[model samples]
Structures are given as structure tokens and as C-alpha cells.
Target: MKVLQINSTVNSGSTGRIAEDIGHFLLQQGHESYVAYGHGNRPSSSRLFKVGNEWDRRMHGLKSRLFDHHGLGSVKATKNFIRQVEVLQPDLIHLHNIHGYYMNIHGLFEFLGAAGIPVVWTLHDCWPFTGHCTYFDRYACDKWQQECHHCPNIHGYPQSWLIDNSRSNYRVKNQIFNAVRVMTIVTPSQWLANHVKQSFLKTYPVEVIHNGVNTDVFKPLDAPGAGGRYALNAQNYVLGVANVWDTRKGLGDFIRLRGKLDASIALLLVGLTRQQTDGLPKGITGVPRTESVEDLASLYAGAGAFVNPTYIDNFPTTNLEALACGTPVVTYNTGGSPEAVEKGVGYVVEKGDVDGLALAVRRVLVQGAAFRVNCRLKAENFYDKNDRLQDYLALYKRLCAVASHQTVYDGLQN
Candidate 1:
């Protein structure tokens, strides 16, 4: 089988790693694989197709801001991509996170509808269903259910500075997206699957496949100097990691925890930008963003507990990573975060409940040394990277079989 995976990046970020994993999995199974991505480092094994350059990205972003055309720009590049897809003639096309200002969504969907390709779209966020924003949970908006006009999150990501074209964008997206005859929807969490069922995307079958982490890299290590590097011996630390530190990821919640928690227990935050980490609060230790998974694994092993206070998330793999490192997790009950953290492995508090969050941290710590083994076991049982990749391979084979049968029937009729 020949597979072509489309995403914003090839090997970096969560979604990119998913695409790369699928590519490598296909190759190992004696199938051809290709990856088409917008930005970031491309993996060495996969046949890579670069969608657009940095200039194209900047221009598309500008156009989106001025015209409220988040996905309608970059026409020429998208047309070229259509030709490239035609050449590949993949057995299946897997799509992930197309809202990164690279492809002209209108052109891509039009091609898919015309070509009648078997498509599997893994929705990493709610952007595909919404008019403007990737996430509406933070805003508590329900307008996406009816029609996404007068979008409340227009000023958010892929921000539109001038016009409100959500009504038009919503209409156009529905028309083009529904034109594709064969498409399957995949979500990383049941919560996202439920939301997709309530939206225009409900017409298709929805599958829930939780995201996985590379357990081998994230596994517990008794490395020398792990504790001393972070000064772990002197203080009890609660660890938090994010690609960015902001209100969405509970930066403010951590700040609030500092005042509430005992002075002996310290807060350690990783993956902050230099600017974000510049200001020093009395009780929190801020670390800049890192690409080294090994470093993160060591940090996770050293910390007393991993705390995720995200207000909105879709099956965060960070929880799995922490668990893989044999660290107990205390996370806010948001989206699929609590789902990854099985009973006995971690604690979950309601969103924005700072007091509850702080208590959960202490509760996990009380569970102590015996509980760390449970965390690692949970990761091995549920969040192994190879098992999750196999799930995708199985889905592809099933969908391709159906597509083949339908093609044969259509040919007979003709």
C-alpha cells in the first residue's frame, strides 16, 4: 500500500510526530510512505514534500489577518500540491492539522472531492469544524453548532485584524468539505469525537485513538547527577511542561499554586520561551524550551509529581511521558487529559480549581515510591507508541478495502 501523510510539519511537534510515526510504520510493513509538510525538520526516512516556504507562510498569515481568509490564501502553492498528489496517486491520504497557513484549504478540498480519494483526516483540534478559532472551549462558545457567524474568537489564533468573514468561511468550508465522498474522521480523544459528532462533520464515522508517547526515550533512568542538576535534593518539586507557557496551559494556575503550597514544595516549569521565563517569581523555577527528550526524561524522573493545569487540551501526551518516566501525575480534568491518567496512577481536579489542584499534588506525593511503578505500568499498558501506530495501520487497511470494493462496483455499473 502507498500512503501519503499531510501535516504542518514532518517530525516536530505532536501532530508532526504522529505523521512521522505513521510513515515509518508503513515502511516497516513493506508499504511505500510519503509525507508532505509545511515547516519544521523533515524526517530522514520518509519521502518528503515541502508545501510552502517561510515567505509563503508569512504572506498567508498576513492575508489571513487582513482578509479573515485563514485557509483560502496560497492558491498557486496549493495547485502545485494538487498536481503532486495526482502524481503520487496514493492508496490513502491522511490529513492532520491543515490550519497552519500553508495550504489553501479550498483548493485542497476541491481536489479531494474531484479525485474521489479515500481520505482519513485526524483532527488535532476543533479548527476543521469551527469558522475561525482552533479551540472554542476557552471561550465557552456554542455558535459552531448552528452557523459560525460573528465568531467570538476572531481575535484569537490565525487572528483577523480587520474583517469578520467567519460566516462566509463557514459556508464555503461546509460546501467543499462535504463534497468529498469518502472520508473518515479521527480524533485523539472521545471529548473531541463528541464535539465532531455535534458539528457538520457528524456525517462521517468518527474514531477515537488516544495519542501515544515514545516510552523508550521517556522511561525512568537512574542517571547520575539528575537530582543535583535540578537541585532536587534540597526541595520537593512539582513539574510542569508545555510547548508554551500561557494561561491556556495554566501558567497563572502555577503562579497561584506558589502562594498556596507549602514553602518546601517548589514549582518547576519547562518549555517556556526566554521572554516568558525572564521574570522570576519567588517560588517557581523556569526552564527554557528544549528539544532534548532525554533531558526531559531525566527531569520527569527527578520531580516528585507532574502537574498539568491546562484549561483546554486534546489528549495530552505529556501525561503519558511523565507516567513513562515513573512520575505520578496531577492534572486538571480538561478534555482527554484525565483519560490518559488512569486510576491509581494520578489525580485529576476540575478545571481552574487551584485549591483542588494543589491538594492533588500533595495526594500524589503521599502515594510515594510504591505508586511510581504503577505510573510506568500504566504507560506501558495504554500509551505505547508502537501500539498506537498499529491502530492507524489497521484503519488504513479497512478504509482502503472499502474504497476498493466501491471502485469495482462503480466500474461494473459503467
Candidate 2:
């Protein structure tokens, strides 16, 4: 089988890594695979395509900022990509993300509809269905259920400084997106899948395949030596990790957690900017964001507990990583986070309850070693990267069989 996967980034970020993983997996199975990405470093793999140049990407972003015309810019670049797609003649076209100011989505979907090829779209977020926002949990908005107009999150991602075109955008998206006849939607979380089933995209089937973690790179290290390398004091450490720290991700809750916890318990956060670390409170240690999975595993191995206070998320890989590293997690009971915390592995506190968060942290620390073993067991069973992605291969085989049968039937009728 020949497969083409498209995403906004190639070898970095979560989605980019997922795309790369799929490409590599297909290659291992002795199938032809190609990856097309908008930005970031291209992997050294056999077949990788750059969708647009830096200038084209910048122009696309500019158009979106000025006119709220996201997914519609970079028309020529998208057309060129389409021609390449036709030449490649992939047996299956798998899409990860089409946003990020790189593709003329209307044009791309139109080509898919006309071609009638089997397409599998893995939605990392809800942006494809909604008019403007990628996430609406903070607002608890249901405007996306009926129609997306007068959008409250117009100022959010694909941000527009002027004019609200959500009503028009919604209509345009509905018309273009539904045109594809042979498409299946995949969501990483059942929560997002449920939401998709209630939206205009409900006509298409939705499958839930939880995001996975590479266990080989994320496994626990010898505990004592791990903290010493980072110059961390030998005290109980509550760890939090994010690519960025903001209120939406519970940065404020971490601050509050520090104030409430005793001085003996240290609060350490990875993925903070140097400036953000400079004036941190007395008991809190902030390390800059790391690209090294080995470094992350060391930090996770040394921690007493991993705390995730994110108010909005879709199956966070951080929880999986922490568990894979044998660290117990204490996460908020918000969006699929608690799903990562199985029995005896972690605790789930209500959202925004700093007191409850503090107590949960204490509870995990008290049973730290026992919980560590359970965490690793849970990760091995449910969140192993190789195991989770096998589902995709199964789905691909089923779809290919169906398409082959249809082709034969059509030939017979003609």
C-alpha cells in the first residue's frame, strides 16, 4: 500500500511526531509512505514533501490575520501539492491537520471529493468542525452544535483583529467539508469523538484511538541520581510539565499549589522560559523547556508526583509520559486527563480546586513507590505507542478491502 500523510509540522511538536511515527510504521510493514508538512525540519526518511516555502506560509498567516481567511490562503501552493498528490497516486490519503496557515483547505477537500479516494482524517482538535476556535471548553459554548455564528472565540487562534466572518465561515466549511464521500474521522479521545458525533460532521463515522507514548525513551531511571543531575535538592518534588505555561494550563494553580504546600515539598516545573524561572517563589524550581526525551524521563523519574492542572485538553501525552516514567500523576477532572490516571496510579481533583490538588499531591507522595509500579503497568497496557498505532493499520486494511470491493462492483456494472 502507498500512503500519504499531511500535517502542519513534520518532525517536531506532537502532531508532527505522530505523522512521522505513522510514516515510519508503514515503512516497517514494507509499504510505501510519504509525509507532506507545512513547516519545521523534514525527517531524513525516504519520501517527505514540503508543502510551502517560508514566504508562502508568512503570506498565508498575514491574509488570515487581516481577513480571517484561514485555510483559504496559499492557493497556488495547495494546487501544486494537489498535482504532486495526483502524481504519487497514493492508495490512501491520511490527513492529520490542515490548519496552520499552509493549505487552501477548500481546494484540497474539493480535490478529495472529486477523486473519491479513501481518506482518513485524524482530528487532533475540534477546529475542523467549529467555525473559529479549536477548543471551547473554557467557555462551555454549544454554539458549534447548531451553527457557529457570533463566535465568542473569534479573537482566539487563527485570530482576527477585525471583522467576524464565523457565520460565513461555518457555512463555507459545511459545504466544502461534507463533499468528501469516502472519509473517516479519528479522534484521540472519546470526549472529542462524542463532540464530533454531535456536530455537522456527525454523518461521518468517528473512532477513538488514545494518543500513545514511546515507552523505550520515557521509562524510569534510578531515582536518586536523576534529581542530583538537575541540582535538585533531595526533597519531595511535585512536577508539572508543559510546552508552555499559561493560566489555561494551570500555571496559576501551580503557583497556588506552592503557597499551600509545606516548605519541605518542592514544586518543580519543566518547560518554563528562563525569564519565567528567574523570580520564581522560594520553594519552586523552574527548568527551561527541553527537547530531550531522556532529560524528561530523568525529571519524571525523580519526582514524587506529576501534577497536571490543565483546564482544557484532549488526551494529554504528558500524563502518559509521566506514567511511563513510573511517576504517579495528580490531574484535574477535566477533559480526558483523568482517563490517563488509572486505579492506584494517580488522583483526580475537581478543576480549579487548589486545596484538593494539594491534598492529592500529598496522597500520591505518601504511597509513592507502590504507585510508581502501578503507573508503569498502566502505561504499558494502555498508552504504549506501538500498541495504540496498530489500530490505524487495522483500520487502513479494512478500508482498503472495502474500496477494492467497490471498484470491482463498479467495473462489473459498467
Candidate 3:
């Protein structure tokens, strides 16, 4: 089957890496796969398309001052993308996050909705339903559910227009999406899937598929001399990871947790600048994010437990990687991160309760080895290579059958 994957990115960043992984998986299974995306500094972007035109160029600074509509591109950019799609003639179009730079979403969806064969859209965030922001956290803004007038995150992502274009985007997306006969929504976590079911997009069928990681690469390391592991000086180590130390990842909680930890306990954080890490307590070690996956495994294996203090998430791959490496996780009792930590795999507590978080971390440290095994076990049972790859292959083949059936029906009508 020939598959076309549509996303804002292809290779470099987190979501781009995910799209690439899926593409490679499909290729290894003897299926023809191609990825289309915008030209970013990201790893391997093919089928480049610009976001806007000359008018856009003049208005971009003004727009940033107002709001940035992430998905909406210029009319010319949209037309070019449509022509590209027509030439590719993919059997099925699988879309990941479209919020990144590139592609005219309004035009592309309208065209796809009209030309629908089989389209599977993965909701990587709340951008599709929201007026602007990719995620709302627990902001609980119902504006997107309604007409999106007076949107909360108007000057947020996607559209940074001074006015609320929520109603228009919402209408267009709903009309285009619902018009397509073979459209399905796939979310990385059940938490996200449930939200999709509850939104204005209630009509679309939503399915859950957790992201997977390679076990061979993320496995335990017997010798931990790479980053210089501590000998657990009278206390255990609690670890945290963030591609960025943004508020969304709950860096505040990490600071608070470190303050409450016993002196012997160590806190290790990855992906922070030295300037960013300077103010933390003495025992908390700040390590720059490693580009090497093998090096990451050694770090995870050395930790007494892995902690993910994310305020919002949709199936974090980091959790999967830690679990694959037999590292116990302590996460909030909120979104999908907790799902990554099964019963014995790790601990989950109320969100923002530092005392509870610290206690949970302590509990995992106490029975750290057993919890570590459970983490690895969970990965083996759910996110192993064969299971995830097979699921995607089956989904693609099913879409192919549907597309063929639709083609025959269209021919008969003609």
C-alpha cells in the first residue's frame, strides 16, 4: 500500500521523530511510504511548502504582535500543497500534528474533504478543536466548544490575529472534516481520545494507540560510567526529563520537590542550560540533554526512579523510554503520563501536591528494583515493536480496502 504521512515536521523535533519512526516502520513492512511536510530546521522534511506570501511577509511581524495562527497558510502556499498531493496520489493520507509551520490547513482540509478516500488524522494536541492554543491545560475554556468568540488564547498559537478567528476556523474544520466519509481520529492516549469524543468533533470515531519506543536501544546498561553516576550517597536519585524546561513540563514542581527531598537524595534533570540550572539546590544535578539514545539509557538505568511532572501531555514517549529501560516513574494523577505508569510500574498522586509527589517518589525508591521490573514488563506487553507496528500495518491495510471500495463506487457512478 502507498501511504502519505502529513505533518508539520518530518525528522528533528519530538513529533517529527515520531512521524519518521512511523514512516520507517511502514517501510520495513514492505509498504511504500512517503512523508510530506514544511521546510523547518527539523531532521528530514520532504515536499516543502511555505506558510504564506509577500503580504504575509509584511504582516508577519504585525501578526506576531497580535496572534499567530499556526495552521493557516497563504492562499498560494495552499494551492501548491494541493498540487503536490494530487501528484503523489497516495493510497491513504495519515496526518499527524499540522500546527507547526507550513501547509495551508483550511485549503488542504477543504480539498481533502471533497476528495476523501481514507484519511486518518492523529490529534497530537488540542489545536484542531481550539481557536488558537495547542493545549489549554486545565484552563477549562469552553469558548472552543461554543462559537469560539472572545477566545482565551487568541494571541496564542496558530492565529495571532488581534481578533478571534475561532468561529471561522471551527466552522471550516467541522464542515471539512465531517464532509469526508472515510475520516477517523487517532489519539496517542485514551485521555486525548476521550476529549475528542466530548468536543464538537463528537461525530468522528476516536481510537487510542500509545506511542512505542525501541527496547534494544533504551534497555538497561550494566556499566554506568558514561555521565558519571553517583554511588547513591546516603540517598536515592529521582530523575526528570524535558525537551524544554517550560511551564507545561512542570519545572516548578521539580524545584519544589528538590527543596523537600532529604539531603542524601539527588535530583537529576536533563535539557536545561547551566544558567537555567544554577539556582537549584546542591544535590540536584543538571545535565544537558544528550543527543545519543544509548547514553540516555545508561542515565535512566542509573536513576532510582524517573519522574514526569508534566501539567499536560498526550502519551509521552519519554515515559515509554524510561519504562523500557526498567526505570520506575512517578507522575501526576492527571493526563496520559500516569497511564504510562501502570499499577506496579510507578506511583501517581494528585496534581501539584508536592508533598504527595515527594512521598510517591520515596515509595518508589524504597521498592525501586521491583517497580523497575514492572515498568519494563508494561513496555514489553503493550509498547513492544511487533504490537505497535502490526497495529499500524493493519490500520493502513484496512484504509486501503476502504479506499479501493470507494474508488470502484465512484467509477460506477461516473
Candidate 4:
């Protein structure tokens, strides 16, 4: 079977790596796998297809910023990609993060609807259904249920400064997206699945597949020098990590939590910009993002507890990574962040509760290495990369088999 996966990146961020992992799994099962990506030059095991050029993305961004028409740009790029897809004739198409200023959604979905290819779309966020923002919980907006207009998050991601075209965008998306006949929607969190069921896309089947982590690389490390490498005092620190740091990620809450914590318990925040790191308050160590998974594992292993104060997320892989490293996690009760923490493994505090976060971190620090075994067990049982990848392979086989049977049945009827 041939499977083509389309995403915004390849072998890079969480979603990119997931596409790579699934491609690798398919190849191992003796299936041809291809990845078509819009950005990032990361090497992948699967056959690679570059979707669009930088200029295409720039134009798309300009269109979005000026006209609030994000997915409508890149018409030529989408048409060219459609030609390539027709030539490949893959048995299935898997979609991820298609809103990343690359593909023209109208053209792409029109092709999908006409071609009648089996599709399994993994929604990494709510952008596909919503008109403006990838997430709307922060603003407490529910307009996506019926219609999206006068978007509250108009200035958010896929940011539009000049116009609010959400009403028309929503109607157009509803018409185009629902045109596809054979499709399944997969969300990384049940919270997101519930939201999907409430949206216009509720007619399609929705599945919850929590994101997984590489346990072998993320497991407990014996690196004693890890502390000194990051200028950490010892294993007496609470760690916070994010791909990008901002107020939405609860960066300010971490700053407040530091004052409530004991001076002996150091605070280390990873994945900060150099400028952000330099401007950090005292008693908090800021480290820039590290590409090496081993380095992250070392940091996770050496820390007493992992804290994620994010106000918005969809089953963050950081929580699983920390658990795989035998480090307990304390996260906010926002989105699927708390789902990674099982009882006795960690704690889930209410969102923006600096005192609650501090108390949870202190509790974990007091318990020390005692929670390590439980944390590792939880990760292995629920978030193992191998198991999760296999789930995708199984889904692929089922979808392809059904499609093949339907094709045969149609031939018989004719």
C-alpha cells in the first residue's frame, strides 16, 4: 500500500516527528510511505516532497495579515501539489497541520472530494474547524459551534490586522471540508475530540490518539554532569519546558511561582530565547531550546520535577517526555495537559494558580526519587512511541482495506 502524509514540517516539531515516525512504521510493514511538507529541511526516512517555496509562504502570510484569507492563498502551489498527488496515486492521504500558510485549502479539499481517496486527518489543533485561531479556550469563545464571525481571536495566529473575514471563511470551510466523502478525524486529546464532535465536522468519525514519546531515549539517564552542564546546582530543581515561551504558556506564572518556592529549590526554564533568558528574574535559570533529545532526557532525569504551566495545549509531549525520564509532572488543568499525570505519578493543579503550582512542585521535590518508578511505568504503559505508532499503522490498514473493498464492490455493481 502507498500512503502519502501531508504536514507543515518534516522530522522537526512534535507533529513533524509524528509523521516521520508513522512513515517509518509503514515502511517497516512493507508499505510505501511519502511525506509532503511545506517547511523545514529535516531529513526523513520516507520519500520527501516539498510542497511550496518560501515565497509562497511569504505571500500567504501577507494575504492573511492583510485580508484574513490564510488558506485561500498559495493557489498555484496547491494546484502543483495536486498534480503530484494524482501522479503518485497513493492508497491513502494523511493530513496534519494543513493551516500553516502553505496549502490552498479550497483547492486541496476540492481535489480530495473529487479524487475519492481515503483520508485520515490528524488534527494537531482546532484551526481546521475554527475560522481564525488554532485555539479558542483562552478567550472563552464558542462561536465555532454554529458560525464564526467577528472573531475574538482575529489578532491571534494566522493573525489578520486589516479585516475580519471569519464569517465567510467559516462558511467556505464548512462547504469544502464536508465535501470529502471518505475521511476520519483524529485528535491527540479527548478534550479536542469532544470539541470536534460539537463543531460542523461532527459528521465524520473522531478518534483520540494521545501523542507518544520515545521512551528509550527519554528514559532515566546516568549522566552525573548533566547538572553542571546546564549550570543547575543539583537534582533539587523544578524544570519547565516549552517550544516557545510567552504569557500564554504561563511564563509569568513560573516567575511568580519562584518567589513562593524555597531558595534551595532552583527553577530552570528551557526553550527560551537568548534575550528572554538574559532577562529572566533571579533564582530562575533560563536555557535556550536544545535540539538533541539526549540532552533533553538528561535535563529531565536530573530534575526533581517537571512543571508545565501552559494555559493552552493539546496533549503536550513534554509531559510524556518528563514521565519517561522518571521525573514526575505537575501541570495546569488546561486542555489535555493534566491527562498525562496519573495519580501517584504527579499532580494537576488549576490553571494560573501560582500557589498551587508551587505547592505541587514542593511536594514532588520532597518525595524526590520515590515517584520515579511510577512515573516511568505510567509513560511506558500509556505513551510509548512504538505502541502509538503501531496504532497508526493499524488504522491505516483498516482504512485501506475498507477503501479497496468498496472499489471492488463498485466494479461488481457496474
lDDT of each: 0.86, 0.86, 0.74, 0.90
Show how many residue pairs clash in every candidate, following the order shown: 0, 0, 9, 0
Q: On residues 289-345, what C-alpha lDDT tens digit does candidate 2 reach at each position?
A: 776777778788788899999998888889999999899999998887888887799
Which residue pairs clash within candidate 4?
Answer: none
Instruction: Looking at model 4, report the run of 10 residues with the lowest lDDT sum.
Output: 221-230
Clashing pairs in 3: 12-43, 67-160, 68-158, 68-159, 68-160, 69-158, 69-159, 69-160, 70-158
Name the regions of candidate 4 deviating beyond 4 angstroms: none
Predicted candidate 3 versus true structure: per-residue lDDT over 1-414, tens digit per residue: 778887766575567777777778877777777777654444442333334445653443354335444455455676876887788787888888765555666787788877775888888888787656677665767666665656676655554656666677677666665776787788888988887887778787787877878788887666552446544432257778878886778888898998887877888898888887887667788877766677777777777788888887778888888898888888887667787776898888778888988898888888877787788888888887557767777887887788788889989999
RMSD of each: 1.7, 1.7, 3.0, 1.2
Which sequence of candidate numbers ranks them by TM-score, best first?
A: 4, 1, 2, 3
lDDT of 4 by residue, 210-232 (tens): 78888988998666526677678
Q: Quote each prediction's TM-score.
A: 0.96, 0.95, 0.90, 0.97
The local lDDT score (0 to 100) that residue 84 gets in candidate 2 is 96
Tell me the lDDT of model 2 at 57.
Answer: 96
Clashes of 2: 0
